[model samples]
Target chain A: MAGRTARSERAAGTGEVLLAVAERLFAEHGVFAVSNRQISEAAGQGNNAAVGYHFGTKTDLLRAIVRRHAERIEALREEMLERTGDSASVRDWVAVLVRPGTQHLAELGSPTWYARFGAQLMTDPVLRELMVDETFGPTIRRTLEGLNRCLPELPLPVRLERADMARNLMVHMLAERERALAEGAHTARTSWHAYATGLIDALTGLWLAPVTTDG
Target chain B: MAGRTARSERAAGTGEVLLAVAERLFAEHGVFAVSNRQISEAAGQGNNAAVGYHFGTKTDLLRAIVRRHAERIEALREEMLERTGDSASVRDWVAVLVRPGTQHLAELGSPTWYARFGAQLMTDPVLRELMVDETFGPTIRRTLEGLNRCLPELPLPVRLERADMARNLMVHMLAERERALAEGAHTARTSWHAYATGLIDALTGLWLAPVTTDG
Candidate 1:
């Protein structure tokens, strides 16, 4: 039992390092353009097969990177979800949707790459399914259910469409800000908390926006 | 005069084919992942240096692709601008920002790659600058000026922030819809016309949305 625990502990350390290195490379280059060997060498592993050994395939490596961030984000979201407790306010509900991801990035501190990395995954057709599959579950669905309760007047299709808009806004905006910070470009808001506040306000407007039903 | 016209016309024809093929390949793969050689080979040019010979560099090639789409969208926006004529209605101003690109896509028929190709460029760290430089100029600035004239009540920072949000929403959403259409996935609105209407409606709400000023 002790030996197994020791071996797994060492594996966990390597996994963390590999995930961090992979996220940075993927963020800078691209998920598809970077190879496993490059990741292994950049990770300081003498063996070229370190990435393949640690994570099975390129998709699997991508998933592992997503899972690392998603777990933390889900926890943050779950905590935010608990505070709302069926609040009917549109702002509160929208906060539930936008804040967790931004707040998690905020907590992660400066030079974060998950936003850029995730944006790349979301934009890629084949990888988008993997990202959605790995990251979304009961938490996000429940947030939507909570948000839906607040916007009952919105039709089903419009509601779904607005939800899509909100999701895109959060992902892309966060990635933009992250990129700006990395590149030393000016950001409108001073802090992530402030940035998240800005997003919640815009998204609240988006959710409550009047739908122009097609004729 | 006839000889000169024919020479220029032939050059135009090659340029058009190259831009179309590049847009398709960039949309399917990625802007950076696809090389000039691959693009040339797939474009069926016998010369391996066709992209280099014609467009000079990758950045120049990307600019040409953008220039092709931007010219048409600008023409459409110009017509829309003429009708707007400094109208103070927020919806009219917003329509100027949203409609032209969608209308151009509508005119282009099915399986269009510009939206997806543009989205990928917008998301890339380096390419996004070239995209903005090549595409945004007096036309977009004029539209924003027209939009701003109507929204004097909103704070400048919020206005700027919302404008950024609006741009992100439009680009990413259009790309997602284009991807869905290409993949034969179900899209909410049946046509690009309807999709633009939905975007205009949502953007109207976004612009008109009451700002939550950070204290």
Candidate 2:
């Protein structure tokens, strides 16, 4: 039992290293540009098939990377949701929607790769669905429901369009900031907290914007 | 002289075919995943090196594709700017920023790939700079200047941040709509004109949103 426990722990350590390496590489390079063999090699594994052995396939590995981040984001969202508790303000719900990811990036400190990695997944034709399924859970739905309650007059189609706009803005803007920081470039906002605040303000306006034209 | 003209015309036709093929492939598959040889083959060029012969490098090919579209978008923006002409209303400037791309896409009809192709470029780490340089020409800058004129009270950092937000929203939102249309899926807005109107409304709000926090 002792030997088995040690082996399992070692395997877990290797898995963690691989995940970290894969996420950074994916963030730096395009997700589809990097291969499983390259990931295993980068992780210091002698066997090129180590990623396959550990994570099954490329899509599965991509899903694992997303799941790791999504789990933390979901936890953060859950905590924020509890604090929010049926808030009537669109900004409050927008905060609930936006803060978790930014806060998680903050907790991860500078040069974080998850934002860039998530953007890569979101941009990919096949992997977007996986990222969405992993990241957007019950907490997200609850936040959106809260947001919708505040905007009863907004039409459903416009609501949906703005929702897509909000999601795209959130994902890609975070990625842009991450990319800038990673490259030692300047960003307009100094901190993720401030950045999220700006986003919430903008998104609140976006959700509450008058529907000027019919679909 | 007549033979030379015929040769140049045929070459131009081949270039157009290659651009169309490359854009669609890059949209369907990730940009880095598709090769020049594959593009040449798809374009019915006997020489696998035709992409290199016609366009110097993969980056150059990508630029050529962007340039082709940017020319049209620039013309559209120029016309819109002539009409907008120092307008103080944020919505008018927002429409100036949003309409050219959407109007161009509208002209392209169904199964459009430029939005998807451009989104892929924007998501890419290396290629994003190329796309930005190729597309964000003088007209875009003028439109933004006009927008800034409208929001004289907004802080520079918040304005810059919201500018980034608007861009991300525009690029990825159009891509999402194009993707849905390509997949024969339902989109909130049936036409690109309506979609642009919806986007303009949301972006007008985003730009005009109050700055509640310091960056």
Candidate 3:
């Protein structure tokens, strides 16, 4: 029993190490550019087929990374949903969706390659469609349903139009933030928090303007 | 003089043919994935180096295609400015910027690759920055100046923020439209036109909202 426990702990440690190496390399060189051998080598395992032995393939490894990241996002979403009860406004819902992403990115000690990987995925139709369907589709659907309920006076098309616009704006801002960080804009002064707050406030105003009918 | 005219016309025709083929190939495969050989072969030019002969390199070819499209945009901007007559409403200016893009895409008859190219460019820092500097920089600056003069109550950051959001929304709409088209949706039924008009109206409302508060 002691030996089995020790082996399992070692296995968990190895898995963590593999993920750490994969995240950095994937972020730096993109999913297509990085190889399984490189992940193993970088992890200091020095085993030729370590990635396959563990994660199966490069594509699988990418999916794994995405899955791991999605869990964090899912948790954030759940927490936000819990905080935002039935009487939440459109602006409140927008805040819940946008804040978690920016906050998660801010808290990470090192800049991960996920953002770059994501940028590449935007151009790749297959991966792009899959990621959208899996990650954003359900979340957006739920958010929109909540928003529509909150703003029933707004036309369905109008609500969808605003939601789509807000979503695109968020995606573009995230990409822009990644570019700014990559270009050496000091995170201390121009933190993701400042950027996210500005963007969310602007987008929230845009999305909520239609329902308010004052605009 | 007749011979010179003939040669010039042939050169122009060749350039057109090369661009036509290059655009088709680039749309089918991405800019990085397609090769000069494929473009030349598809264009029915015997020499695989025909792309190089006519346009220097693949990057130059891509630039030429973008420049061709941009010329139409520039012309539209000039026409809009002329129509505005120095005292345009905020809505009028937004309409000027939004209408031309929607019309151009509708009329261009080119494959949706241009839209995809644009989506890729937005996420690409080098290309995005250059595009803002060269193509959009002067026009945006002038438009903002005009808007500020017309609507002085708005804050500078608010103006800049709305402008960025408008541009980002436009790009996203184009990309989404292309996807819809690919999925067999008719252009008339697509949400792009409605979305653009909605966005323009929203921005106009935002711009005019602060005025009402002061009054």
**lDDT per model, in order?**
0.85, 0.88, 0.67
CAPRI-style quality class for the chain A–B interface of candidate 2:
medium
Please list the residue runs of candidate 3 whose C-alpha ends up more than 4 Å from where it truly belongs after superposition.
Answer: A1-58, A137-139, A186-189, A210-215, B1-12, B150-158, B186-195, B205-215
**Of 1 and 2, which scores higher on DockQ?**
2
After best superposition, candidate 3 residue A110: deviation in angstroms?
A: 4.6
First chain of candidate 2, TM-score: 0.92
Of the candidates shown, which would achieve the greatest TM-score relative to the real structure?
Answer: 2
For residues B10-46, could you state the per-residue lDDT of candidate 2 as single tens digits?
7779888788899999999879889999999987789
Q: Per-residue lDDT for A88 in model 1?
A: 52
Candidate 1 displacement at residue A206 in angstroms: 1.1
Q: Considering TM-score, where higher is better, how would the candidates rank from best to worst? A: 2, 1, 3
lDDT of 1 by residue, A51-96 (tens): 9998999889999999988999999888887877854588888888
Ordered from best to worst lDDT, the candidate numbers read 2, 1, 3
Q: What CAPRI class is candidate 1?
A: medium
Stretches of model 2 off by over 4 angstroms after superposition: A1-12, B1-12
| DockQ of structure 2 | 0.70
Of the candidates numbered 1 and 2, which has the greater TM-score value? 2
lDDT of 3 by residue, A124-144 (tens): 544566556546845656776
